[model samples]
Target: MRRVSIFVLCTAFLALTLSTGCGGGGEEGPPDSGTPYVPPVPDAGPPDAGPKPDAGPLDLAPPVVLSHSPEANATGVPPESFIEVNFSEAMQTSRGTLQIIPGDGLPNNGLLVARPEYWDVTRRTVRFSFPLGLPLRAFLTVNLANFADVAGNVTQGFRTFAFTVSDGVAPSVSSTSPSEGASSVPLSTSEIVINFNQPMDTSVGTLVPGGGLSLGTPSWTGNQALRAPITSTLVNNGLYSVRLENFRNINVKAMDGAPYLGDGKLDFGTGPDTIAPTVREASPVEGATNQQYESTRFVVFTFSEPMDTNLGMAELVDGSTRTPLATSFSGDGFTVTCDAQFKLRPGATLRVELTGFKDRAGNALVTTPFLGSNGALDFTMAPDTVKPYVTQTNVPEGATDVYPVEVFSSAGNPGYRKVFTFRFSEPMDPSVTLVTLHDAQLPSSFRNLAGVWSPDRLTMTLTISPPSSGLPPIEADKLQYLELNRLKDATGNLLDTTIPPLGDGRLNFRTLLNQRELNHACEHAETQGPLLVTATSSVTAGTPRSDVLHGLYELTLPGSGNTFSGYTRAQLITNQTQPIFMNGAPELTVTDPASPQTGIGVTLLPVPPACPSITHEARFGTVASPLNLRFSHGQQRLRIVLEDTY
Candidate 1:
């Protein structure tokens, strides 16, 4: 047919050029149809295989955080701490994650997850378990987020860290109040305390006032005690010392906060009273004469033992010029005064003298040529025509509650403010009675101030500030008549707006919330009998009414770290709000008992309004039972049925 189809296409193209071998020189291509053609090699299939292209997507890399363990800020650490971390590869233990964060004294807020107690088999370390042990002085932190890595790559961590724990136990001074070589210790021995051996850190522990001794405000009674007090200048029997100074800022740390490593000092003495404060009673009684010009004068001295209110004074001569006196002292430092600017000439004669005194043991009064005969006086005057009048007052005119205890026992409890005097019968004219003695209800720019007058000007006092810590059932409403009405009288007249108290002078009174809690339990009674205690519960029946609800009885003696000297019913009710009824033997005096009959009593009852009820009571006495009973915040639960002492 076309030559038999070209001989079957030339025998299938010569069987595809004899299985695809195109020769060059010995060419058989196309049957040499062209003599130089060589083309048949197409069977290279099976050797080319088929599966190999993904080495491209399996390599990741992000998992770091290869080490950890209480190593960050470290520090003592022993309340039972445990933290470990380590992870650079393994990890993916279900995605991992952890968090801790607490800073001071810790309470809760810590999270964790990595299961299997998070062991270390390529699960990449972990291990955190504080259960209930990490809190004494805490700091913590430790984060470690997300975590991954089984090629899921994550965790590239540093995570976060910090650590503290502390049990290295350091804070010392287990006891001391006047002990170490203690002698008579009384310049009125205010306080000393100290205790410690643990539980401190309310600010590091500081007492200071060293060698010559001074200290005044240093507080803290429970977490191991502290107290302080002293300062009214102390001295008296002299030879003091007092230190402590540890501070990381309050430093005295212990409960694990550590600190209080050095300075504790101590040493005491004072109780010889060497007798040197004369003037044991003065006030125009040393020479006596006519007296009475415009009255309102004052001189008072009475000091047989404690004085040195920075060396007192009081002058009014007529032949040596000297006038600088503004005194005030009587919280039992033994009276002093001077008052009444001294302006009386009438028949003329005057003398009065007295000078720079001293006592608290340093002794020294006869200053220059004055105090020689126990101090001078002389007097004479007597002309004044009579116009003043308001007689005595500190809170009387119809008294009701009353007990501002002279503004918190002379500078304590809200302390300082609460003045309120008013004597006047004459001596008027402190520029017109400090601008017309006021408090009419207050604000005429609020006047009413004219203290220090009685050396025979006939009296004229009038003060009036009050209110920082006294009126809560504590009293002071009726000042009823401390009035003055533009005052006058040094010889100018005026004052007597028709009497009834210079014209209305109202001073209504009303505070005695239990008479300053019975004068703070009769000034802290202590019939003597071993003493050392501790009690706490500031307000926990419902929580909230704190005019100082009494939570710490703390007297220190029942064993651990003793020492806790006088004054503490919260330093005698600070910023008080009444409600007191204390008792513990002569004001808690243990002197150094520590055992025997160890008793400490306290009672605060008067928080009745609606919030948390409140009515406290506490008694401690037990060297094997002198009668130990304890109760708190009223609900009425006194059983009483003992009988097991055989």
Candidate 2:
């Protein structure tokens, strides 16, 4: 093979346990002092022995130690010492037959569980270690029955005799009952357990209570586990411990299923694991009204795990000015309520800690002396709170237009309606738009229509799906109104009430809620004309010619000023395109300027009221778009709605 070059990569962190493939030789034990090798006189022996008897090759295989060491039946060895084995020959390194086993209650002794670094064949030696818990001269027997020599030969000898270690003192224990910092000890507590560095006596039948601690019962969780039933009672949540100095431990056994040496008490802890509390977002909201918080309310907290109820309370602070605050807590966790008066100085925050706390087991916060640095929540408050208002709508007072169709009802009744547009001078949050219909007998709903925005998130273009049906005619007749409130501008200022439904970020106009438009332009239709206005005593009354006829200038919303009274009068005419029904006696409607019937706001003229003493109303009309011969209809006005500004 060509010379090899190895590229270096980062070294691996895990350890190696098993090894593969080994080379070695098989051999017998050292020669006995009396046996000597003798050389044969080849030719002479063959001639003297006559036919040679077809002899096979002489066996020169190395010797392997089948049995030896500790001389079996020996005594007085350290109880802590572990058993070992040796072979006369260097063996193949592996988990193969060369590996050793212990003869005891539990077998497969190389190790109950193999560790990654345990199976290496380094220098033909393998070792394992563990501590013992029993007290007595324990006898241990190791077997060579499963291993083989390097030549793959199964040695016929399987060493089985055993040896004993001297009984030794077990572990020692300091204290047993009353765990550190225990508050109160309970009499209901049962089973007083103690611990020691060494194993102790545990034959229940012996009746010798070691260390004055009672062992009233002898029951193990199983054949290999241990437990003690003491005479004292352990109240719930009481502290206690087991120690050899004042108490006794249940006798522990060895791997060989026998007690070796026993003495001291051992340690065992109990209880459940606990979780830390969590804190979530606080309220009164970042920039909203910051008035009196005396009724401020409780703070809510979320936790990642079940909190240790024993960990105690959390203190609240108006961190802004470092002012101390009184706080209340909910039964669950994390959620706390602070006195509303605890104002967060202008722009400030707070923090919560979960350290210096302990669970029932005295398990401190995972963080040593946990000063609760791992968690916290923050908030900011604002002053200066104001209200909102509406500006003017882009519709004219007493506006009138004509159309070319009898598309509206013509039973000598007045029916009219239209849309009004408004423009704002500044940017606004569409969510603040408050729209409502004023008249009765109408089903109303405000849907946030889809809109386009101007460059920044500032200006919003919103639409309203006007009412189509489910309303009485009265609301549509007299007049429809528009009201608005809570309109907010970009800089977070309220819209000026003096302004129209539209507004600019800075200020608004305080315009009164009074305005009206005349809708009397209802009559016949002519392919080409301004409009027709035949005046009867009223738009709803079937009046005779005797009703003084007049032009479409008399419009008023009762309490609103009679704005059209100063306008010039008009003749009767009509635009056949826009028409309406004679419902609500006489109702009036406005029109969208961008529509085909833009100037057709005046289409039909209504008959005057036969009884002038009665109120006059007007319904609405529909506009149509026409092609060379075919015509497309514009918006249909079936009902009218109105509202006031706040």
| TM-score per candidate, chains pooled | 0.27, 0.25
So what's the TM-score on candidate 1?
0.27
lDDT of 2 at 521: 27
lDDT per model vs. reference: 0.51, 0.35
Worst 10 residues of 2 by lDDT: 1-10
Clashes of each: 68, 109
lDDT of 1 by residue, 533-595 (tens): 333222122222211232323232221233222222221222222233332222222111234
lDDT of 2 by residue, 1-646 (tens): 1111111111111112113213555555675698674433333332333223344443335436544444587664455454445556544444323222343333354323323233335323333334652124666654545444444544466556566655654323333443322345444335543322433434421223432334566453432234467675332333344432322233332222112212322322332333322333344432234323223444444332334454444444564334334554456533445443323333344443333434334444342122234443344444323333333343433222211111233364543322234454444565554544333223253223244345533444433332453222213233333444455655466656554333322211212221122222232220112222223322232221211222222222221132211111211222323222232333332333235244333333443321222223332232332210111112121111111111
Which segments of model 2 are wrong by more than 4 Å?
1-55, 59-164, 168-331, 337-381, 385-493, 496-646
